[model samples]
Each structure stands twice: as structure tokens, then as C-alpha cells.
Target: MKKFNIFLMLIFIFTTVFTACEDKIIDTTEDKIQTSIKVTHINIPYVYNVTNESDITIEGKGFEQTDSITFIPRGGQGGGTIKLGIKTIEDEKVALENSPYFRDGEYEIRIQRGILDQLLGRTFVNRIFNASIPDREGMTVKGTVHSNGQGVANVIVSDGIEFAVTDQNGVYYLPSAKKHGFVFITVPANYEVSVINTIPQFFKRLAGLASATEIKDFELFPVNNENHVVAFMTDMHLANRNNDLTQFQSFIEDVKNVYEEYKGQNKKFYGITLGDQTWDQYWYSNNFKLENYVDQIKSLEFPIYNVIGNHDYNPYVSANDWLGAAEYRKVLGPTYYSINIGRVHYIILDNMQWLNDGGSQGVVGERNYRDFLDQEQLTWLAKDLSYITDKSTPIVIATHVPLFTNPDQNGNFNNAMENTSELLAAVSEFTNVKVATGHTHINYRNSPAGSNVYEQNIAAVSATWWWTGATSAANHISRDGSPGGYAIWEMTGRNQQWYYKSIGFDKDYQFRSYDLNNIHITSATYTPSATDEFKGKVAGYAGEFATANKNNQVLINVWGYQDNWKVTVKENGNTLPVTRVRKKDPLHIISYEMQRLNANAEPTSSFVTVNSAHLFLATASNATSTLEITVEDEFGNKYTETMVRPKAFTYSMR
Candidate 1:
């Protein structure tokens, strides 16, 4: 019995031992199911200012549409796990700035791909080291890192110099480097540095005062709080009939995009169209139906104002200046008007009959143009100005014909104006004024009247004149450079900022202020020896009203070499209005009733003539009397033996 009992005990003990060993073997087999993933690399952690450090960006190839990344503090204190939020495939940016669950400490960043309904994807685990960087020498460098926490091996840390790649494990060491320093990775392709809290482009190196330097904390630039105003328009000329509707619609869409971006902002913005709203080149018929045009504009969220361009009135163009004033009034509200926005007032003037007189067309001669703004319109303007006396109000004058030009000094085609004296007189009474126009399919800005009145001539949206050439005078280039774009004006305090961005020219295109700082009265001068042609030079005042008061009697000294030339005071080309105070002395106290005269009359054949013996007279004084004078040409272009004055002025003064 004793022998049998002993044997049974031995058997039981053996069975127990064998079962325990089997169980242990099975547990070890199950543990092998979870494959350990080796983190191939951990990029440099993004470092923003250490103070408000919040958003953290960790980029790598393993992230997917539905992956969850959890961040945990490696050793605890002030650390916690943060789950990654939804990821977007577009823009490819992970916004971690708003996440509040993470703490400042060494963190274990682990990402797991694929979830409940999907198959397994890759997994990654990385350690993030956060430490405060002190100022050294004259620089302060803030830094962060990702590693396996062991002596990081095979790691590379660069002060942008002397690259030091680590050993086998991912370990990096930034040795005591320069005082004021810069450190950036020699990032291999497919790898990106942490760009978070840094400049927008992260791959670039990091820079700052060194650890031993006394550093000043960086203060972020103030945000732009000023409201933005964008002027939008399309189908300006309706160059080609077939292309009109599409171009018009596209313009409205572009404007809509601008309005959508700044809808809630306080800056009030709108659009303006300089008529021709339809293609009217060939047919007297309306370009695209007006209903369609209005529908397109109504699609825009902002209000739009229109001015009748020539094409809009081509129906009556043959009669009295294309579509006459009565028709223009019926089609697009008033031909001229005014509106006020904020402290700025805008005056819209109609200049369709630009060639009413026999002078050059377009920009050069103003007399040839029909009574552009009729007497009725001029009266309205005076009334408008009477109400607009506040010198503080900024005024913008808009017309189809730009009032200034940089034309070669003698070009007869320079269509600025024959009667601009009246306009300048009216405008000089105000403090802040600007003028804008577009008839030249080019982008040019000039202040012929006065630089203080910012004058801008926008480029044409359509390159109709030069549609086929390798090089055209229109000054247009490729698509981004063409199909044209608009200007964005932003006002902050008393400063007016202008930015011209081409269509599709990157979202960041901005208007640059070109040397407008030292703008003051002392920087300019007024001169009385100023004529349409022999305008005397005024220092620092390129485009200025050279007016002198007779009471002030500021003498303007002028010199003429030849004889038969006598200088005298006059008004509107009339020697009658001119009071002869002194001869030989060019200096004269300018009376408000100032007349323009020249030693001789240079007859230009290019100008249209109403009669056989005459060219259009620009000033009224020369119209009454046939002023006979010797004509001379320095270039020796054919000169008539003697120039004869015409019987009548261009068109009777409007």
C-alpha cells in the first residue's frame, strides 16, 4: 500500500508539472501575435514661442484618414494622453492649437491606424522632449525634439553647421554652439521639420539668440484690423461679342469670392462698371441683353454702380455722341453722380463725348471731345462740392478719361484736357482728393494735377487691341498677368494702402506703399510761370497746381531768348483778361483770372480742323482773334509758313 501511494503521488506531481509547462508555452505563443513596430524616424518637434505653446504638429507618412494619435507624457507630471482629431486630406494641416488636453512635458506620441470597421494599417510611437531654452550671448533659441528617450543614436542636430548625425539609435546632441545662432536640419527628402509655431514654412532652419545671450522676447506683429475694400468688374469693353457673357459672369464670380472673404468685416466695399457693359463694337444693338447683365450683377452680394460707356449708347452715337443724354439717362440711372462712404466721398463723372472738339482723341486733347460734362452737369458738380466742404473728407474722382498722363511732352495725342483749368480750380479747394480712370489698356499712375491726389489708371481686363502679337503695346502678359485683375484699397487711420494683385496671382499679392512717408507741403512748390506747354519747374512738386494769388503777388521769373515774345497776364488764352504789368519780367502776380499765352503758335497738323485755315483753339481768348505767330519746330517737322487762328473754338464752351 505504501509503495502504491508513493507512485500515485509521483504521477500526480509529474502531470501537474507537465500541465503548468504547457500553459506557459501557450501564453508565450500568444504574446508573439502583437508585432513590435520600429519607429524609422522621429522628426524635430515644432517649436513656437515657449510661452503660449499649444498646437503641436507631428508629421510622418503613417498617418491616414482615420487614424488616432495619442500623446502621453513619458514620465507623467503635467502630462496626459491626447487623442488625435479628424484628419483632412486637403490643405494637409493638423490644427493642434486649440487642443487643451495636452500638458507641457516629455510626451510619448503614438499613432494607430485603422479602426472598428477597417483593416489594420501601420503604427508608430515617438517620444517628444520639451525643455525651456535660455538666452545666451545675444541670442535666444527655443527648441523641442523627438526621440526614443535612450541616448539618441544616429540622430543629426545642426546649428546649420557641422552636421552631427547620431549613432544606431535615434539620439541627437546640440553641442554648446554659437551665442546668437541658427539651427536647421539637413532634412533629407520625404522628411519635414516641425513647422508649428514657427514661420509658415517649417523645413527652413531655426534661428535665435544663443543660450548665453540676453534676449528680448519676441512680440507678434499686430493683426490688421482695418477693413478692406475691393473694386470688382468684368466685361469692361465686351471686346468680342461671343465671349461677353462668359467674361461677365466670371467677373461677378471673382467679385463674389472677394465679398465672401470679408462679409462680416466693417469695411464697406462695392463694385463699379464703366459702361459698354455689353459688346457694342460692331452692332448698334445692345451687347448682351441688359436683363442678363443685371442678373449677373445682382448675383453679387455687394451693390454695384454703373456709368454709361460709349458702347452703351452706340444706338444714338451717330446722332449726338452715340446714345444721347436722354437715352443714357434711361439706361443707367444718372450719367454722373456722387456717393459718400465713411469719411470718403466719390464723384463719378461722365466723359463720353471726349472728342467733341477738333483736338486729339482719348487722352490728349479735351476740346475735341463733345461737351463731356454739359453745363447742367457742371452745375450739379458745383452743388455737390458746395455740400462737400468738409476738408477732412477724402474725395475720389472717377471718370472714363483719366485726367493725367506721362505722354512724351510734345505728343498731340495727349488727351488730358483743354479745360482742365476749371476742374483743377474746383478740386484745389479740397484737402484730400484722388482720381481714377481707365481708357488706356495699361496700368499707369501719375499725378499731373497734383501728386497729393492719387491718380491710378488700371490695366484693361481684355487685351482686344493686341490679341495676336508676341509683344503688344497693351502691356499685358500671360493669364495671371492677363485677363487682368483689380486693385484692393485698405484704409487705416489716415493712411491709405493700395495693393494690386493680378487675378490668380497668389492669395498674398499686396499693394506696396512706394516712398510716401516724407509727404508734406514743404516738399512742394507753386509757380506762376506755368503754361500748358511751358509749365515752369516746381521743386519736389511733380504734379502740382502752380497757382499764385495776385494779392500775394509772388513773382515768377521767366526767360525767353527770342523777340516778338511779350509776357502778359490773360485768362483762358485771352490777352484781354491778361493785364500787362511788366515786360521782360516773366514774374507776374497770378490773378484767379489767369490767361495762357505763348511767344508763338506751333500749328499741329495731326489735330482735326473744322476749317481750312485753322486748328481747334484750346483756350477761349485765342478763339476771338486770329492770333498770327511764327511757328518753329526744333525737330524740323514740316512747319507752316505762318500759323493762322481758327474762326471758332473746338466746340462752343459747354
Candidate 2:
């Protein structure tokens, strides 16, 4: 039940637009200066869509006092208010002249008040352009993208397969076959398109035959973001279950605080979500779907360019991959697109092909998808890269799954994305290419030996599926012990830097040190009051720390560790040997594992504490010896921890 409030005086800003009485244009105006326009279905509460342009019939009251009608385009397109005089006038109904029809897009209609000062319906119309497309030679779609009294040049435009760029006059034409039935732009640097409900309107749907021609245009506002800060958010997995809403609110607040802190630094802020905004399993059961996901983050001040994860497909549309992604494409623009922020050329891809094996009209499927780029995406990537002449431009390929998998205990890497070779070869020319991804629910950076591409497989915002901190409000740690948070990327011209920001903690909180002396998770102490089903379910040392040896050892979990990062430990003012080791995070074991065990429930294996390669081990001289730990990333930023011997480890320890 969301409403778009429209006032008659809005013409000075948005509009007192269009005479068409369509959609639920609820009159929420405060002044009551004039009545609003509404097209109420006589038999039922229904609003008609803009189906035809020739026969524009508006049936509503207060039409006698209506002077003119206007149509305000959504998402801040270049064209101003499209006002039209009423052809027929009456107290109950009226119709505009059979001309000046709206193109294929969303628009808000408003009533121009007459001298009598009567109220009218301020309606919102989704104009459906089903006209006969004209045939053209050499170009199928053509238009000019202009803004602020002039045309902007060198902007990239595409229809998924074919790519083109605007000329010096800001005019471009695509010789497209209309394969995807939509055209979009790669919103160039220093400019941005407007948005509706947090979704960027960088694309427009097409009409008619493949051989037909259609003209589509996009206008944007110029911005100064050469030195910008983008919030790399990912893996929301919002399903209205396990208190996810509460946790998501906390995430929003955390982002807002971060933005406010950096608001006055002469830098613009933007957000990019790595995907999994909603769970398809709960779309029908909880009555919360893609639209609900948009409403959740509507309070944010900036527009969020999104990526599509495997869980964001239509579960019951297994008839085909295209059908499965229909809802996502309809709700959140295109599945795969690109945009420019500063010197960074970002390409957002949809690698998860929804092969929902056993789905149907009303039945759920296996909900399984793969981590591979399809042929079409690869082709589009090639077409997009062809337009960029500067090979040194920092390219960021954002997908849901990592292109390269994280290394294991023996420093061995496995192929996660099936199309890694193709993807690598595609971007091999770029000198500073990087990939940002999620879905592992753990933080890890993958840098192949001599490859130009680097990957940061970030963790989830809803850490551990919002389970660890549901009731206790403690330790919202990921599988690798990274706290529930997002990545902060600072871009200055061609140079880029990033760091993992733990929510509820400062930016300097990079690593956590655990004193083995005070760390032990035993069923006797944690699940002592549990029932028989889960009495001895918990284990000490979490499988790795199962032994009873009282070795004076310290384990440090550096969630943001990479190959070039350095770790050092000093005990009693003397340097101690530090070795990289794979082990489970103890705090995660107590915060998530023991919590479920104490509740007499078998903990999910996926959510359980697992061995992480980012861990380091150091042996101390004595149990009472104080140790100082320092970690330095490749960017030369250092974080330190001073361990006052037998440092207490608790579920809520920071």
C-alpha cells in the first residue's frame, strides 16, 4: 500500500501533470488548494494502464474546473512538463486530443487547476508503447542524450548485445536487432540518472519487431565525484525471517553514520550492492518480494546500483531462464549493465543463470543455480570493452560469486566460477582490473600469481543469515569470523583503495586476537541445561581446539587478509614467530554454535564455524606473557592489538 503524493503546485518542481485518470493517485496534499484527478473503476477498485495513445479517456469528477493536463516523466528525463489542453470537458469525464502521446515509460499525471479551484486526481501512469515501429537503415534505435542546455558526448549506450557511444553532439544510433527488447546507457563519469524507489532509470523498454526502429534517450545531471566513496554492500538475503528486518535496520543506520562522517570531505557518496537482496523462497509465503526489498532501504539518501544473485530469481518460473528473471528485470532495471563513477569503469554482470530445475506455475523448485557467465554475458562484455580505449582505466567487474576461489589450508586454490578462463581472457588487457563479489558469507581476497584481475569476495550484511544475533544481540560473525558489515571503497582518480568495515565497530577494527587460555567451547559449560537431543552436541576447541593441551598459543583472525598483507606478533616486548594457519574462530563457535546447541537444536553445517585461511598462529613464552599483535595490509595501513595475557574471549567481545 504505497502512495505517490501529488499536489497541484508541484508543477514548479515535478508536475501538476497529465489529465489521464489512471493508477491510484491518492490525494495526500496538505493545503487542499485543489481537488485531485482519479479514475475509479465503477465496479471494482482498479486503475487502468496507459494502453493506447489514440483513445485517451479519463473518467473522474471535478473535470469542469480542470484547465489543462500535464505529464511529468519519472527519473528526471531531459524533457520538461508535457502539457496538453483538454479536448472535451465535463463534470464527470474528459478526454485529451488524439496527439502528443507518451513514450514507453513510467509517468506521473497531474491536473492543472482552473480559476474555480476544484480538486483533481494526480495519477501515475505506466505508458505502454505498443506502436508500429518505423523501419530504418544502418540504425535501429536513435536518440540524443542532452542535459543542462547542452549535449554530453562520449557516453556509452547498448542493448545488451550491441554497443555504441554518443558523438560530440551527444547523439547516438544503435544498429541493434532489438534482441533484448530494451536499451540502456552506461551512465558515464561525472553524471548520473535519476531514480525511483532507489532503482536507477538507466534503461528503457523497446516496442515492435526486431527489424523495426525505436528512438530512446537518456539525460543525466552532472556531478563532481572524481574523489568519491562508494559503499560496497552485499548479501542482504532479506526474507523477513530470523529477525532480518531488525538487523537490516542496524545495517542502514551503520551506513548512514558512515556517510555522515565522510559527508563533508569534499567527496560524493554512492552505494553498490553485490546482490542477494531478497530470498525467493519467502517471496510467496511471507508476501514479501522484490518490491518489499526496495521499500526496506528507501530511507537511504543515495541511489544503489544493484547486482543480481542466484537467490533473486523467480522460483516458480522454471519454464525457462528468461521467464525466471522476468520479475527481477521488471522490478530492478536490467540484470547486467555498466556505469562509471570516477576513473573507475564498473561492469555489473549476472553470472547466475536461473536453472530452476523442477519449478512450475505455483510450485517451488530446487532453487539451484551455477557460478558461471553465460555466452550472452560474455558477448556483451566484449562489446562493452570495445568502447573503452584506455586500457589503464580501473575496471571493476561486480558479480555475485567470485571469479577465483579462496585458497585452502595448503595454499591450494580451486576453480569456483566455471568461466574463469573466459572471464580472465576477456579482461586480460586491463592493467588494474578488480572483481567484487559476495555469496560466500565470508571475507577473502583472491589474487592470482601474475594476473591483472584481483577479487574481493566480501561477506554478508545479514551475517550468518541473521541467526547469530537474533536474541542475544552478540557476535554477528560470518563463517570466517568477519563481522556483519560492508566494504568501503575510496576512489581518487585512477587510484582505488578498499577495506572491510565491521558494523558496530570502527574502521580500524580489522583483526581479532583470541587467547587460547580463556577460549574453550564445551557442551558441559555451554549446553549444560539442554535436553538430551543436544546435550553433547557442542565440542571444545570447535573440532580443531578439541585437545586438552595448555599450549600458550594465540590465534588471530584477520578477515580482510590478502597475499601481500603482513602479520607480526611481539611477546613481552620480544618478537614472536607468526605462521599462517587455518582454524575456526572461537567467538563464532560460542556466539552461533553454542547458542543453537543450548537451545536443543542441531546447528546447520553451513552456518557452523569453518576453518579459515586468513588465520595466523603465534606461540608465547608463558601463559601470563603479554603479546602485541600488528597487522599491515598491502595498502600500508596497519592495525594493532595488545594482549594483556589471558585476554578474555566472550560471545560479545569486540
Candidate 3:
């Protein structure tokens, strides 16, 4: 009986301890769930008058009594940190008030629970001029949309929620609440909104308490034509220095000249800089002033759009890390917006995310990184796409980072969109989609296997980060041997064609070649072999000549090589197929190595060309008299260049 009692007690104690442990685990999990807050909806007006304090209700999940809310101004003047007073808090609802001195722009709201934080929502606050009190009925906001002083009908105007269409006389009227903030337009197709002092003049601000109706007018530039030509330039990295501005102005002149050259082709010219308009570090030091750059860009005859790059972030003002883009919003209107020109819908996205850590130079207060589109942006994109009822309309997505890219030499992805697969899935329903990006400073085009979308990664305007002018080339040449340039894309209804235009070079200058004298080539393809000495050489001869042994080889780097493109070499009038090679441009390698060897050499390159996927190789006997290289791009543009067989040059191998 005594033994039985002891065993039963032991079992009971064991059971008690196990139950307590399980309870503890359950408690920890419940706490985690409570801290994982998510915002579902916000009952804030799209626009709030700056003169009045507005009440906003935030509805979300995972709210605790200890939680607090904050409002951070996004862009424009009168922006700083303003904590909202939470009048009430519930499990699903939190009511807060905006500051009386709120700014005239978009504001970001955030929720803080202990050490955990999350973005609650965003609202736009504006200052309206000559406003009045509302009668029993709301006031009316009227606007007229015109193109080059001529009325344009069927234009959609809105106040971020209610929309109105312009009449035959190009006039639109919308009922506005007494506390309305801004009256904006939807920007009709084949037309561009006017920009004043770098601010897109698509909206009219309403301010003060009044009793009269508001009147605003908007002008859009027409771009309707058979051939619509748009320029894609990226990574200007304009510093505050005069030299950088000079280079950028020169590039702008080149763009103007290109427009002039094609003026007689019945093409309408428009240009957009993909991103990195200004290096954040320099701009921040200059007190975030952009008047000069804005003036320069505005001087362009054609309408030019801007994209938000990682380097264009504003980090000094806001305490919230994600609010670094506030300056960009102030300087440039909304960071992400869409416009339609003819049959193509151009969606500009802000994918650069600020890390809050110090930048590369460690001078800028904050570090900005790429490849993230927040939830708010995703929601906006879905809504924007829903308005496009015509599924056949081609879509052009322009961003700073590439949505899809080939892996680096180590078989790893670099500087690509983090949510690429998700983004692609969202746009998968669209048949014709082209993504244009700039940041890699190399020109590349590829179509993912099953996506059927062509992604073009353009070279930087400030080629090699403004390092090319000191090299022997003395031009804006990227590390990939692609000259710093922009791309010209022509859209005709649903069909599109594009080509990279080097700033100073003619359109025909697409590729460069090197002749290798008789070196034993055993590989059937020009692809870099593990045993090939030339593939690893980086400090040998410069320019288009390479020593060969028993195998006479010809190497080529087609800067704009696409899958549909083909390269063929005719040796002594005999046509021979050229094999694609994974090798770096010999010119880039030599230039970089020479600069490295001589410390006194100017910093003429930012990246070394390690391996190029667009390279090609062809081999022939030493007796071959001449070599004629022919390249045909995807659009059936053929370019041929002939070179005389040169005697083998000797140089010490690296």
C-alpha cells in the first residue's frame, strides 16, 4: 500500500509539471499574436485642409492599451514629426487627430506597440486657397483640361475618391466636402500633365474657410502619333559638383539632338530618367536643394518624367525609417503613379527601401537599399490596373531596380527586385508587358522563361558613376564596355521596338570585337572554359587585338544582344556560326587593370567587368584573309563590320 501511494504521487507531480509547461508555451504564442499588429483600413480623408485639425479613425488588428500612433509628413513644406493623440483605442478601431499645423502633402501613419512598430496608413493633407464653408449642400470644384490651349474632352478628374468626366467643352465639376484638401485630375491618355518648378501641376490646393465654388485649370501636352518615341535614362547620380552637372547637361543635349534627328519620322518624343536623379549624399549636404537640377531638367524641350532611385532618398528629417522618401515626394509628385500614352500604360513604381543605416560613404545620415514595394503600393497598383479595362493594352513598368535579371558569375542574384515573383504574378494577366530598369550600369535585355515579359536593364547616364571621362576611351563607357547612354523605345499601338543609343556614338555602334591569333581552342563554344587562359586574363593587350596560338579566334561583345539576336562571322567569304561566350569584355578588363596597377591613375571605373553573357566567340585558321562580323537584333536590325586580319601582338600575360 505504501509503494502504491508513492507511485501515484509521483505520477500526479509529473502530470502537473507537464500541464504547467504546456500552459507557458500557450501564453508565449498568444503574446506573439497580440504583438503582430496589422492595419486593415483607414477612415481618413484622401485630403485634409492644413488649417483645420481633422479626425481620423484607423481600423486594424492586434491593438494593445500601451500602443501609440504617429504621423509623419511625407513631402513638401511644413513636414516634421507629429505624434497623434489617440482619443480612443479598441481591438479594431483607433481614433486619432491630425496636428493643426499639418503640412500640404502626403503623411504616413505608424503604430507602435512597445518595441514593435508597423506602418498604419497614409493620408494627404493640403492647403486650399480661398476656401469657404459648405452650405447644406457641398461645394463644387470645377476644372478644365486642355491640350496646348485647346479643350480636351473625356478627361477624368477626381478628389482621390469621387471622379468626374469632362464634358465636350473639356470642363469637369465635382462636389467637394467643406473640408476638402486637393482637387486632382486622372491625366487622360496620349497627354502629359504640366510640371512647374519640378512639381507636377495635376492638382489644385484648397485652403481656408469660405462659401464660394473653386475653379482650377490644367494643361496636358499631347503625344498622340503613329510612332511614339520615349527615352529611358537612368542613374544620373548628379552630385553638387559643377563637373557632374556639366556632364549631365551634355547628356541632355545629346537627348535633344536625338529628338531633332528623328523629328521628321513622325515620332513624338518623351523622355523619363529611370532613377538616381541626384546622389542623396551630396543633395543632403546641400540642404536638399534641387532648384538647379530642376531648372536644368525643365529646360528640356520634350516632356521628361522622373523615377525615385535609392540614392534620391531623404533621410535627415523624419524619425521613421520608411519616411526617407518624403523629400522625393515633395520634389517629385507621388512616387508611384501611372500615365497612359496611346496604347501603352506607363506605371512608375518606387521600389527603393531605406535601411536607416548609414550610407556607403557613411556620410549620408541614412542608407537606402533597393527591391521592395510596400503593401500600400501593391494595393494602389491593383486598383490602378483594375481601371484598365482593355486587357490588350501593353504595359510598361519603369523602376530603378530590375524586376528580373540574370544571376551573377557566382550564380547569385544581385540588385534585383526582392518581390519579383510576386510582382510578376500580379501582372501575369497582361499579355504584353515590358519592364525598363536602370541601376546595374550595364545594358541587358532578357525575357524570363514562362513570363513572356521582356525586362530591359539600361546602362547608367553617369556611366561607371561618373568615372569614364578619365579613361583612354574618354567617353561615358560602362564597365561592360557599353557606353553610358539611354534607350529609345518606339510604341505603335500594341507593337513596340527599342534600342540603346550611346550618347555620342551612332545607332549602328552596337558591338566591339577582338581578334585572337592562333591559340589552340578546344572548346566547341565560345563560353568561358575552366581551362582557358584568355578567359582569366585581365592585364594583357588593350583594344581589339588578342594573341592566338594554334587557334585563330574572334571575340565579340554585342551590347544589346537578345534571345532573338544572332551573330555570324564570315571568314575569307565563308560564313561561320559564332557561339555565345560567358566572358568579360577584354577592353574593360585591360582598362580596369591598368588603372589598378597605377595608383596615380584617375578613378576611371567603379566596377570591373568579370563576365559578360552577351559575348560571342568564333574560331578560324590563321590563313583567313578577312573577318566580317554581322549582328542582327530582335527587331531585324542588321549591322555588319569588317576588319582586316591583324598580325598577332605580343604582351606579358597576367
Q: Candidates' lDDT values, in order?
A: 0.39, 0.78, 0.67
Scored by Cα lDDT, where does model 2 land?
Answer: 0.78
* Cα lDDT, model 3, residue 70: 79
After superposition, candidate 2 runs with Cα above 4 Å error? 1-135, 208-212
**In model 3, which range of ten residues has the least summed lDDT?**
520-529
Write one digit per residue (lDDT tens) for candidate 2, span 442-528: 998887878898899999998898898794636688988899999999999988888999988999999999888676666776777
- The residue-by-residue lDDT of candidate 3 on 1-654, one tens digit each, is 999999999999999999999999999998878775655655555555443444666666555566688778664433367777677777777767656655455678787867777876677655432234333345467656777656688776655445667788677777766243556666666667655543456665553234555555566776665458889989887775636667776787888788887777777777777988877767756643444457567667776777888777765533343467656655665566666777788888887677756543335564546478777677757766777777777989998888766544332344367887777876878888899999888877767766657788898888777754544434466767777788999888778988888877788888877666633222222223223444333223232334334466777778888777889898778987778766666555444444433333322344665466778888866755688889998788998888667634212111
CA lDDT of 423 in candidate 3? 74
Model 3 lDDT, residue 84, Cα: 71
* Deviation from native of the Cα of residue 74 in model 3, angstroms: 17
Query: What is candidate 2's CA lDDT for residue 599?
Result: 81
Worst 10 residues of 1 by lDDT: 584-593
The clash numbers for all candidates, in the given order, read 45, 17, 16
Root-mean-square deviation of candidate 3: 19.4
Please provide, for model 1 over 18-61, each residue's C-alpha lDDT reduced to its tens digit, 9 standing for 90 to 100.
Answer: 99999999999866743533223345343322333444555443
C-alpha RMSD (angstroms) for model 1: 27.1
After superposing candidate 1 on the true structure, give the runs of residues whose Cα lies further than 4 Å from its correct spot: 1-235, 239-242, 264-266, 283-292, 321-323, 354-371, 406-415, 449-451, 465-483, 492-494, 507-654
